[model samples]
Target: MTTTRSAADDARDLPAEPTAPWILVLAGGVVLLWLGVLAWQVAVLPERVPTHFAADGRADGWSSRNGALAFSALIPLLVVLPMPVLSRLVLWAPGQINAPNKQWWTATGPRLRRFERLMREDLWLITTVTLLLLVAGQVGIVLAARSGGDAMPTWILPVALVVFLVAIGAVMARMFIGGRYAAQPDLD
Candidate 1:
């Protein structure tokens, strides 16, 4: 057999084995946990629950108990579920995904699968973090509702928000750096 571009011409290097996250398995559990917690809290919540909070953690906005419950439960699912779905879309339609090397990676099956696997894990990570954040907010809201005052602890949701944002950045950084491995796509 013969090849072009001398011996220097080699196929692209494949990426590292994808490390599947165990928490990914618990995604369903988290959603269920949120539902359970929301149900328990909503039962005890006043007719009006805090829908919005101020910098000082005061209840700045209000909504009906059912409204709060519906929004809280639905919003988290709406937000967290999409990323995983996008991951699947990336697998089905790699062309829609934006990576470092779009053409070479998607040009072959192995390369595209590897990219999709890594992306699936990355998106799952984001999804898991988002679920945890919403859980924290639910707990905080419950605590605020039970509090003797109209304000929460003034640190719970804010801290959770900051942590969630940081986590999102870290996952994105991992995608840009770790997901963008240098190994050639094919390694032929």
Candidate 2:
């Protein structure tokens, strides 16, 4: 016997929870906070600031204070600004989202909603962590410069990159495995 399902039934099965507001707020707050820190630091920064660091964390290149400050401000903006927009796009147009089992997840309204929520949350978490690391690195650099130190720990950047990569890998693995195991709701 073939069973028939209506769009209403499918919609009813979808989770009702909207995107988590705290995630967006927290992500935005981090970006704003770091931007403020950058701006404040720039005011008191010396004439020349370290723009490049050697593997040992020693300053190898210098830029005008304005240039260094601009570069610092750009980092978080580059990393954090596009994430929410992309996340929203994923919700607005699931057909455009590229993922391993894309068709299966986007096959229904409920599945698509779930997928969008998962993707948005994942992006927010990743964006927040990355921004925090970047902000910390900038703060360290500025503090070192203020103290007349020519070197910041060389390991900061490498460690941050490794952590970021690992976090992304973990999130992707979780999504792929979860998607593989998720029960596909019958649409018939």
Candidate 3:
């Protein structure tokens, strides 16, 4: 009997990807939502007055100003509530929602591959910025505690150290993973 190659094998050799554009859309929506939330919070809030909430859980005259900020933040969060559904809607656009589990990979794998590429190209800059931000956050925490006559709790230092180590490990792992992906482009 003669052996025959299947469609799967043919697909493996093809350079085409089957992923839907849902991730791209979802990422855009999230960015827009984040920006809208930030804008409303900064633009609508009072300048310097500290609004007081009454002891009975009611807002006094000054506290009415606080609602503007809270509502600004909450409205965006509410608007973003449909993000997951929107993502699923995008996934379904290519009739992928009812397909088998293998089809799901067919959609997400290319996106993951691209992400690995981006990580490879930007790893050094990402790592540098992340490390600087982590260092700055630690400095801020220390300064905040010291200025208030409060010593950071005994456990906090160790916890912060652990978190910093874990973050560094994650960055290293991302770099290693990206390098591995770059080395084996066919596997993707």
Candidate 4:
């Protein structure tokens, strides 16, 4: 005997809605705010600024203010611009998506869509966090330059690294556990 399931049935069996509108809006807003801050700082920064900091948070390298500011602005641009485009590509082409159980998840429509949605949300979140961190670091550098002292708190990079690692680990765990992409038994 053989059995067939409708698309509706497959969707019903899949997890509930995975994307949240408010979260996406909030993430976008943060990136915009960071851009604004970068622009404002670039306008007001001195002729020379610290381009690098020592482990002790003291300025170790110097550059033209415009050059340093441009580098700072570039970090967020690199993260904010390509992320959404790549996320959309993944959504449209699930075959290109990478994950622990890529084959299993992309095998069925409902599962593939679900995985894509989750991955998109995760990418947005990672982009937001990364931009925020970069912005914070840039702000610290500017403030330190203005103050003529350390360009960052020595603890900032270490703490940020820990947070970044934790966030990535959590996202990966959620993808594997919540996605449940393993082969399922035949309904028939």
Minimum summed lDDT over a 10-residue window in model 4 is located at 179-188
The candidate maximizing lDDT is 1
- The superposed Cα distance between candidate 1 and the true structure at residue 9, in angstroms, equals 27
- Per-model TM-score, in order, reads 0.77, 0.71, 0.27, 0.72
RMSD of each: 6.6, 5.6, 15.2, 5.9
> Which ranges of candidate 4 are over 4 A from the true structure?
1-18, 91-96, 178-188
Candidate lDDT scores, in order, read: 0.72, 0.70, 0.40, 0.69
Clash totals, every prediction: 4, 0, 0, 0
Taking all chains together, the TM-score of candidate 3 against the true structure is: 0.27
Best candidate according to TM-score: 1
Error of 4 at 126 (Å): 1.0
Which residue window of length 10 is worst by lDDT in model 1? 5-14
Q: How close to the true structure is residue 43 of candidate 4, measured as C-alpha lDDT?
A: 73
For model 4, what is the alpha-carbon lDDT of residue 140? 71
Least well predicted 10-residue stretch by lDDT in candidate 2: 179-188
| Candidate 4 C-alpha error for residue 116, in Å | 2.1
- Residue pairs that clash (backbone atoms under 3 angstroms), model 4: none
